[model samples]
Target chain A: MKSIFGKSKELEKNIEEYLDIVEEALLIFERDINRYLEGQYDLFEENLDDILTVENNADDILKEIKYKLYTYMLIPEARGDVLNIIESLDNEVDLCKKVLMQFSIEKPEIKDFIVSDFKELTKQSLKSAEQLVRGIRTYFEEISMVNEYVNKVHFYEHEADKLEERIKRKVFSTDHINDLCKKVHIRHFSEKLAYFSDLAEEISEILSVASIKRSI
Target chain B: MTSFLFISSGLFLGWSLGANDAANLFGTAVSTKMVKFSTAAVIISIFVTIGAVFGGTGTTETLGALGSVNALAGAFVVALAAGVTVYLMTCYELPVSTTQSIVGAIIGWNLFSGRPTQLDVLYKILGTWVFSPILSALFAIVFFKIAEYIVKNCRIHLFKIDMFTRIGLILVGAFGAYSLGANNIANVMGVFTKTSILASLQIGFITLSNTQVLFLLGGLAISVGVFTYSKRVMSTVGRNIFKISPVASLVVVLSSSVVLFIFASEGLESILLNLGLPTIPLVPVSGSQAVVGAVIGIGLAKGGRNVNYKLLGKIGLGWVLTPLFALIISYIVLFFMQNVFMQQVYF
Candidate 1:
């Protein structure tokens, strides 16, 4: 019995650590994107390395959590739901890493007019991801609070969507840039940044359904 | 040897009780994989034996008051009749309980031997049959509310809740098994208590009475049944009968176990009497019906959805039909045992 409880505590600690890493990855993504906007290429590259390291750590902890949940048969009733939540939450971390890596590789030319808009869009998108992590944490520890976090995720996701649309409008309509390719490239990056919030919204839907099923 | 042969029918009844009724205690636990079957089986066998030896006398005395089947042949026939009734009902896919069947068979013996059936005792037994399930339901509702409140307020981690629920299931399953042995052993061995020919034996710091020896034998038979046949029944009960959550299953098991314990416990009765409270009679009640009642209680607690009225009707019908069938079977079997087999079926 003590061993079983010990295994559960270990798994719980691993899950908490994994969530922290995912949250850290999103913070790094937002910071590095701001650095890229400011023309600090060296610091952006350094933070990119930091996010990659965090994402890898999150993946490792996720794998460990899954192994323990399945082999030890913890939470038999909610095992599938918990795994689904964890796997989907991992996708958010992956999206953060993907967005940062794309910015590093493409080095898209950001015109002066839409720079503030890009930074705000990244902040809003990361806010949604941050709320999603909180929602998932509430799902584990305090189920009643999960819906509150889910609603916050949806709110931030909506804010990100608005900012994405504003950035796209500014990029296409402004007379600053002459190259059509540059216009399209800015549009692609804006959509990529906003897509993080969309993914957070999708995961919130899953978390809501799982929480309802879990209620005693 | 003849005594063992005569008591075999009672042993058979005990076996069938174990096979069918152990599921009520551990079905959801095993089916949900919250508690392993091997652990449940071991705990059930040991605690059930302990309960039958120590706590079985109250309900057995109640059965004796209803009608004492004084002859070994008569007791054998009475137990055989109840067992056969249960089998036939199961074959027909009808709900049956050994408690009702044994009660009806003893009443049949009363008629056959030209003895007056004690109307007050019969009424008390009948009243308990009608009351036990309802009481179980009330207990379930209260316990469910308490459990829900704790889960909502405690904010325990899901993994920790899972671990605690697993431990709770095993502990509650043990209690249910003990209550089953205490309450329902009367149905298995009550008829034979009057005619038991077993000699008392001394076992290290304990003296076994003849009745306790009979109960121990009955308890062993029940254990054998649990080991051999209860697994499939637990699966059917856990998966098919109701699709309740593990926490709800815990409440159901706990409620029904409490019902059985109250009905079988003489100590509780004395305490109640001393406190000037109306005492619950020591009568054998159906554990399965109590579980069903508890399930219904949960349904009612959850806004009265998906209650399965048709199943409830069938259970009500079984309450009337099981005992009636047992009485007829007992009457006919006693005739053959006395006339054709040339045995003294009654004296």
Candidate 2:
């Protein structure tokens, strides 16, 4: 398809390049979590160790976003919403790193349903990213597309809440949770991931508000 | 026969005015990137020249006749001295006035004509040294504050606001050039008229009117000043002071011109004297000072935080010493040039 970002190939290239990195990092998290479920705990630990490095890469991308956002100020009609959304995405990546670090140090068992819900959140996040990239490109054209990204994020938040309840209930009922440190670590890891979803959802809501204003 | 010299001097003054005062008109716009330098310069030069040609006789009369000097040679000397003084000031990047420089040169030439310095005129003109800036600044500050408040409090779209403000700037620039033409163009023509030089000029069966010849001469002089000599002072006015918006700069110029017009009138000195203050009417004060005063008024209106006090101090020093510097230079140059050696050759 022809690029929707008006005239410049550069902006499209930048957004696509950053999105690829985020997608790669998210896939690695999913693979590692799946390995842990299969009881390949050592492989999971190795991948979890690799997650910290993604934060550094994400941070570098954040700098590029800042430069681009500053450039936008000079170019007319460059909706500033991208600055806040990109910043939130960077924050989500940071929170992801924290959750992975907790997982590496303290192996905690999450229920199958909870794992599926978390995977669904990841899918929603990717969907949100895809919609955001397209929405930004079509910002001057068909601006209504931003609503789909906003809806997906809110849907992911509800999913995250349900998963949190299922996991917490399982941890309480299961005798493996009798270990105090493991229970605490699992609680912290689950809470951090939930927090990331909340932040991502909030970012999406803000972008929706911005898009509404832009359309008006 | 020396019509060429007077015409040349007037063109030089006009060009210098453009180089210098155009910034007063469009400095803020140029600095803020609302307009480019070349665009501003061309617009200002054209308008100012037009202003001088059509609206500049009053000022030419005031400058030309202020100090009584009878001879054509004396008139030439006065114009020559004024021209050189302004040129030197521009060279040194001082915000000196062409008006004051001409007056000072006239005073020098008057002394040579055996008319002792008119202390009454001198004092009244000097008295403006204190009053003009203070008045201009007070009014400028008041106007600037009002303009700023209107811009802030009015729920207007930014683009529309900018468009309206730009229109305001254009009006103010036109007014400024009109004021220059009314008040300073006379400086170019007054000498010619005083010496009966205009009456002597003839072409075929058509004799040029004094006013018409003056309009052309004043217009051309200011154009030359603008084109040749006004850049440094223009830059200084635009950049040295605080970064002003186009709206604020326009207000300052309008206020300055208003204050100058008040002083340029024939009864200004008489009115001041009637008010029990000793004032001088014959000698015109510096427009540069008037502009500075107006700028200060704008600055104060912006509040103390926005005014660059350091820049004011520097300009203030230049204001105090410019006439004295011109007087000394005129004295030295005239003494040597008119003395035993060169006089035999020219006489």
Candidate 3:
């Protein structure tokens, strides 16, 4: 019996570590994007390395969590939903890594006027992912509080959407950069950053349904 | 040897009771894969045997009061009749209670032997048939409320809750099996008690009376039934009949087990009497009906949705039909045992 509870506590720790890695990657994404906008290439490259490491760690922990859950037969009733939530959260971390890698590769030259909008979009999108992590945590600990965090994810995702639109509208309308391809490239980055919020919103919806199914 | 041959029908009845009623104890746990079938079978066998040997007397005495069935051949026919009725009802997929069938069989024996059926005892047993389920439902409601409040207020992790619920299922399942053995053993071996020729056996510090020896045999027969035939019944009950969550399943098992314990435990009756409180009558009640009532209690707690009124009606119909079928079968079998088999069926 002690070993049974010991196994559960270990799995709980693994899950917490997995979520911590995801949240850490999102934070790195936010900081790196700001560094890129501010012309701090060295710091941006360093943070990119850090986020990649975090993303890899998240994957390893996720695999461990899945294996333990199946092998130990812990939470048989909610295992499927819990695995789905973790996999989706991993995707958000992957998105953060991909966004930073793209910024490094393409190097979209941004005008001063749209820099604030990009920074704001990065903040809002990461906020949605962060809120999603909280929602998943609440789903494990306190089911009733999960809905509150889910609503917050939705709220932040909506904010990110409005910012993405504003960035696109400004990029196309301004005469700051005359190259049409450059405008589209910057717009693409904006969409990629904003896509984190969309992913967060989707995960939050899954969490909502799973929590409802889990409610005794 | 003849005694063993005569007791075979009672053993058969014990087997049928175990096969059918074990599902009520651990059906959801095993069917949902929350607990393994092997573990459940082992635990149920051990606990049920212990309960039968230690705590089976109260309900057995109550059944004795209903009708003695003094001759071995007479007891054999009565038990065989009830067992057949239960088997047929189960084949037809109707809700049947072993307690009801056995009671009806005993009444049939009374009629055949020219002995007067004790009206007060008959009425008391009949009254428990109706009251036990209602009591189980009430217990379910109260326990469900307490469980819900704890879940909502505790803020425990989902994984931890799962762990606790798993452990709870096994522990509670043991109790349920014990109560089942204590309460329902009378239906299987109650008739044989009057005619059981087994002598008292000294085992270490304990001396088992002839009646306890009969109960031990009945309990083993029930264990055989659990091992041989209960898996399919558990699957049918866990997946098809209830469709409740694991936690709700735990609640149902606990509630029904408490009802069975209250009705079967002479110790509790004595305690209540000592306290000057109203004591519950010792009676053999239907484990199946207790489970159904608990499920309905959960449904009512959840605002009365999906209560399955049609199935309830069918069970109510079964309450009337099963005993009637058993009585007729008992009468016919007793006649054949006396005339065709040339056995003295009664005094």
How large a fraction of the reference contact set does each model reproduce? 0.70, 0.00, 0.65
lDDT of 1 at B346: 85
Each prediction's RMSD to truth: 2.0, 11.7, 1.7
TM-score, per-candidate, Cα-based: 0.95, 0.59, 0.96
Worst 10-residue lDDT window for candidate 2 chain A reads A71-80
Candidate 1 local lDDT, B257-299, one digit each (tens): 9999999999999999999999999999999889888998999
The per-model lDDT (C-alpha) reads 0.90, 0.60, 0.90
Report per-candidate DockQ.
Answer: 0.68, 0.04, 0.71
Model 3 iRMS (Å) reads 1.0
Over A16-121, each residue of candidate 2 has an lDDT whose tens digit, in order, gives 5665666666667667756765678877776675667777777887787567545532122222565666676666566667666666666666655456655554
Residue B314 lDDT in model 3? 67
Candidate 3 structure quality by residue, lDDT tens digits, A1-216: 548799899999999998888888887888788899999998888657788788889889998999999999888778999999999888998888887888898888988999999899989988999999999999999998899999999999999999999999999999988999999999999999999999999999999999998877
lDDT of 2 at A178: 64
Candidate with best DockQ: 3
Evaluation by lDDT, superior candidate among 1 and 3: 3
Summarize candidate 1's per-residue lDDT along A90-165 as a digit string, tens digits. Answer: 8888888887888889989998889999999999988998999999998888998999999999999999999999
**Docking model 2 quality class:** incorrect
